[model samples]
Target: MAVIDNIHERILATGIAEAGALLDRLGAPGDPLWPSPTWIPMRFDRPLAVGADGGHGPVRYHVTAYEPGRRVEFTFHPRIGLTGTHTAEILPHGPGSCVLRHRLVATSTGKMRLLWPALVRVCHDTVVEHLLDNAEHAVTGTVARPVRYPWRARLAVATESVRLRAVPVPENARLLKAALPHPDLADAYAVRVPPGTSLDPQTWADAIFRNPPPAVTALLRLRNALVAPFGIDRGDASAFDTVARTDRELLLGTDAGHLDFRASILVEPDDDGTTITLSTHATARNRSGRGYLAVVGLFHPPIVRAMARRAARAAVAPRPQASRKVSATR
Candidate 1:
């Protein structure tokens, strides 16, 4: 297919092996850079290889080709007018250096002409830069340059609260309905993880939201501390309160005097890893509550996404320890 729009970026990295490893890691469910707060979360149904089926959000695709530690490409199944391939590749420079690149080439045949540029392209460009930023950090332990949104992108973000709209819950959310009888508003986010993770749904929920990792805890504390000067109150170590719990799902709640929030994490096991979805709903009972809701909407998407990403990361792997021991080799 002829290429309609494509983005190519190359960044120097410390080691070929490391860069290649990072390329593979980028496809994992827990990748920190992916599923950006403002972008769709991505995953593969099975191990990275040809024929694996998966894609981000509503966009679905099948892996067309794969080369371990070197590259992977996908051919979309036609969503709207989006067709063609998106590939992530690693080009080694020498034993000690390499270049990491991501290229998306596709043609929009229908409504995509309107959707692709206005929506996908804008977000894709920013997301690629972010991926590179993450790659540099993973390969060299330092970012050559920090990722920054252009002024237009920044404006889009500031107004995203207006553009953001909730999509219907997936079939797996049947459990959530039993808990949230009448949700004023509902939204959900999900990602695929490695199969057979020992952590159960409830256990993972507790660790991710109820008890955050040490690093996240410290960061939250620092944020709260900074807000203290402005006389703003902060939640305790347990950022949320559990309203209800069952074997496969846990409902968490938060009360903001005027506004009330309820969210849950439902774990659905599959042949591949578990698919974890963070679903949430908010209610406003009074005029003051309605006012609060209006303000909260502006930042709700990113906030919920950040929480989901943190939980997804924890669900797939154990949290890293703060201290590490270095052994002396004889």
Candidate 2:
């Protein structure tokens, strides 16, 4: 009920507008989670707390700050009435960067002494910094995948009418992998999706190689497609830019300037098939050069996930084998 307002940093960035749009996804309305689409929802990452009390503890949070492209704040509302406030802010500056700040304020009522390190950090500057760098990537007409949410935060994956995951994968490892050597096409992200719901290996390969779905195009927007939100919605400088390099990495630049993201694809074989990991990273040199800018990663784990499920769906679905023909080669 009381008022608490503060500004964390200055503003600049030629790509501020695009950065704001990305943040808008987090607070967009009518999505099952967040009360509003433009704010942090309560159920965002509650499951990560399971290991704390043998999987039986009160976990609740309320949004105290919800502003598009600026700040997001939340308060802890424990069923047992524990006291504390969690505050978070995303301050965007210049044309291609933003600063992220997170603070926790907790007061004990009676004898609640400190236990853990007051607060712990799973993600912060590293994640948001990646977002800002990708904004520049967006501007240069390149696609850079943001680190996936660790398995713990991932929570669940929904496909039509099914959810999978017997046991949870760790939070830190789930979303963040070491910088992969190359961009991940279909074969690279198999591990990131559900085990085996509906996506087929063959179909998956064709999808990325022949016609990739959302995440593929989202990651490879440099190729140019109307379906890409960041690529198509961006300015002509980024949209029309040609891929200067196509091996080891993809280099993108615009007549206005150079875009700040690059990614490559790496492949490795497994006992059954393969495990592809796509890791995308970004950079911000000077914030003041481009006008104020904000950053957001258009994240859709389940959506990126469905592509995998679709492969499983295709694999198990009825298929005609009579049409199969063999070449004359013995």
Candidate 3:
């Protein structure tokens, strides 16, 4: 079989959902392909019918589907040995945009394929060019919305009010605190510690404090390391308005059925280790086509003050020894 393989790429910007739907316009060039009317060179007359095996003409299409997100697959057979399938897939990157990938799985099945592969290469090139152009127009039509940061406050959760969640390392806490004035971050963190343990809150506190589980794509990786490990399908700490300040917390929501999902871990440093809080009031749409509160009560306040407390302890721990030295000197 002759393998004349050539691949070209491009990126198109469109809504995550719209990316796939736009392909409906160009459709497939399978069964019912029409000649381009002199009137419209750019547009096709009707939709294509990509069917099983081979179609009536020199080329045939067999459309097979295995979709997870924005993926569509269909194959074409010019002949027995010289046949191939085309795969088109789109993946959302951030907010309003996605990535589309198109690949041709071509193989030679006949004596002709073994004799001359150049002809096979030419055919593949012709079909791929048309598909690429269609993809470009599909994405160009839609405006790509700017990706935004996370929500800032509770009330503005849905309205694009993004709260600043720190995505830095604990090792940088001392450096970050020092940047703040006396009442600010640095020295305070160096001095203060949480109520228990040698752990200094301010100096060591980062917006994200922990990462749990070994999976590279686990929730800890997503939360940016702010919260602890949330068991699979469960938020680290779930919180609801069971009352004003705090109450019953359900990580997974009422409408969240059939699907096993995870939630965010909101926590605040108390005299104890940490208070994990999960929110139930907010709602967000998931990949499963269901809606639930994204988070109801997730919070991790600044801990520079906590570090200040620990630093104070370090100063006072040697008081008895200092007193004996004073008596000896007298």
Candidate 4:
């Protein structure tokens, strides 16, 4: 068994009551503090209370105590072999100031003993620090310095993102699904859109095509060169025509001598987080088209998945701050 005890705290230049108010809204909609859309959000089956049950991402816990605006405690689910409680509280400091603290006390049993220090601990520490940053930002409107994910933590996140399962073309992707009653090939891939991401499908589509990896660009150039002699369409962005569009979905396609294809980018928002789906429909018009499909199909899924992941990451990345011009005084 491995014992785990972790604590993170921040001193805000605000009264205890003011800091406590931030605590009270922990899992509420448009939450100002749990560091969501960047990290998985904290959620509960219902409004936060003593019996409310939920946890962010893979961790599972249930609320065991609530002190209104001052504090809240959660007990871990036993199935994971994690045993203990975690608490978040606001403590009064000097005049017009208070400290917000989060502490976790737990023991890891079974396989978790090995996993805790190697992987879980890094992610947990990073998450807690981000939470503290959010708390400080909420009270003071800025964080002196925000925590950044270390390379290992970033690797873990990227690994997890690549594992997201392929889902069916959403019903909301009406344009793509309706593009052809019988397409020879239909493929869809999805990724979770972080909180505060642009809701426009156009924005995501642009992100997907913008700044592709050098390897991808090189491969595309090779493909275009190889197909040019066959009298095949280059299938570049310039060849695609907008088939249809809505705030939630953008459909683009191209028609060539051997085949026709449509691609849809859809953004669907729900209670937890937004989902972005990329769906494609292609119809073969001849033997050459069928052969082309057979060859390209092998690479289609991974390419779409990579593009979706890239777009999702772009959506959450912080925008560059605008520079201010200095004035010359007389």
Candidate 5:
């Protein structure tokens, strides 16, 4: 068994009552304390209270104790091989100030002992620091020095992104389904859209169209040049026409002499975060179209996956804060 104890704390200029109130709002919509959309959100089966069962991401835990406006404790689920408790508490500091602290105490057995130090610890440290930064930002409207992820943490996050799986085209993507009723080929990939980001499918589609992956752009140029001699129309972003749309889904397609294709962008809410699914459907118009489809299909999945990942990153990226202009006063 490997014993583990971790603690993260931030001194807030706000009073104990104010800091405690932040704790009370944990797992609530628009949660002001736990960093989200960028990180897995803290959630429970029901409203936060003693016995509330939920944990962010793969970790499982249940609330064991709760003191309104003061502290809360959670014990890790035994099945996860983490036997211990984690607590969030607000402690009074000096006048008009308090400390928001999160501490975790657990023992790891078997493979967890190896996984904990190698992978879990790095992610845990980064997450806890981000949580503290969120607490500070909530209390003071800004963090004095926000936590930045190191290279290792970035690598970990990238690894997770690469593991995203292909999912069936969402049933709610009615527009895309309607456009290609019997497509010869159909594929879909899904990625989680971080919380606190826009859920608008149009916004995501625009992001992808405006800024495609560099490799895909290069490949498209080469494809256009090669097919030019055959009098084939260039396959480019500009050629796509919007077929149908709603708040949750956007369908875009293009018709060519060889093949007709449609692409769907769908946004659906999930317990952990919002899911964005990108689906493709295509129909070959002739034998030549079948040949074209086979060639294009080889490259389609990766290119679509890359574009989807890029769009997700662009959506979550922090926009530059508008500069404030100060006027001179007499």
Candidate 6:
């Protein structure tokens, strides 16, 4: 096996102990100073120490050595054809500064040599730049530039069309209309409930006003986990406000940073029941804004479905007796 080595270093204007501690915690889930979104958020199954086993996604590694407030190294087991050890260390550069260095030494014999240059190098360089930026920010309370996703890294996001079917609850339409301005529905997981089912309006109101269904909560978590790695900012649920509402339609708006977006839930009453349609509208300010919107567009469909389904189910499902009293006043 032939060997390939890469070394990257940065000088942080901080004490050795501080820099070392930060270096030690890199690649863990809760390290505030690590450049998490640069590549992907890395998570360890255990605490940072020798013998800990963890990595992000399919790239697995084991901690090989550790020196408190100084250095830590990992021997990686790549998903494909690479064997290596990567180390991060802090060395005193002066009275109150230190050099943080990362060294990657590996043997790549087969397809890994070709793959490394094509895929891994871009990711590696970005991660290193982020680490340095984060270190500098910790030492001095300023980040030189806000991190943006590289064009290459943007491949992590895929454009997907969203399709959702809204279930109607005609009996509870009146109840739902009364419960307007309830923003939590925007994040719920949807299930298509058929119309004409004997569902109590009060019960459905209680479910919506008081608490979300467990299935909806699970769906929200799944969605968050799916998109978090891509560095997508899912604006806070509380930020979703009722911008417009009427007897037949409701509009919820949220500040998505790059764009002003709204989710519209249109309800049409028919002889059989009501047909609900969940859709999204946005106005991007510029090209960057449009790009941001496009990235977020990948998630908009399923999320809208979740919101509509949750609202539909909550507006039709029977509320528990214990929560009925609480639902009546709200």
* Alpha-carbon local distance difference test for all models: 0.62, 0.33, 0.34, 0.77, 0.78, 0.55
**lDDT digits (tens) for residues 266-300 of candidate 2:** 22332222333332333332442122112223343
Better of 1 and 4 by TM-score: 4
lDDT of 3 by residue, 169-253 (tens): 2332232222221211111112221222222222222221221123322533465453233322433322111111112111222
TM-score for predicted model 3 compared with the true structure: 0.31
Please give, for residues 7-96, the per-residue lDDT of candidate 5 as tens digits.
878788999888888899898887887766656678899988999999876789999999988999999998887899999999989998
List ranges where model 4 is wrong by over 4 Å: 159-163, 285-288, 316-330
Which prediction has more favorable lDDT, 2 or 6? 6
Candidate 5 has its poorest 10 consecutive residues by lDDT at 321-330
Clashing pairs in 5: 37-194, 37-195
Best by lDDT: 5
lDDT of 6 by residue, 185-288 (tens): 22222233333322332233223323555665666567667655545455455545566566655556565544555554455544323445544456664555
TM-score, one value per model: 0.50, 0.29, 0.31, 0.88, 0.87, 0.50
Candidate 1, clashing residue pairs?
A: 195-273
Worst 10 residues of 3 by lDDT: 321-330
Q: Candidate 1's residue-wise lDDT over 258-311, tens digit each?
A: 556777777777643566677877777666667655765665666666655555
lDDT score, candidate 1, position 205: 66
Candidate 4 at 180: error in angstroms? 3.4
The TM-score measured for candidate 2 stands at: 0.29
**lDDT of model 6 at residue 23?**
71
Best by TM-score: 4
> Compared to the true structure, candidate 5 yields what TM-score?
0.87
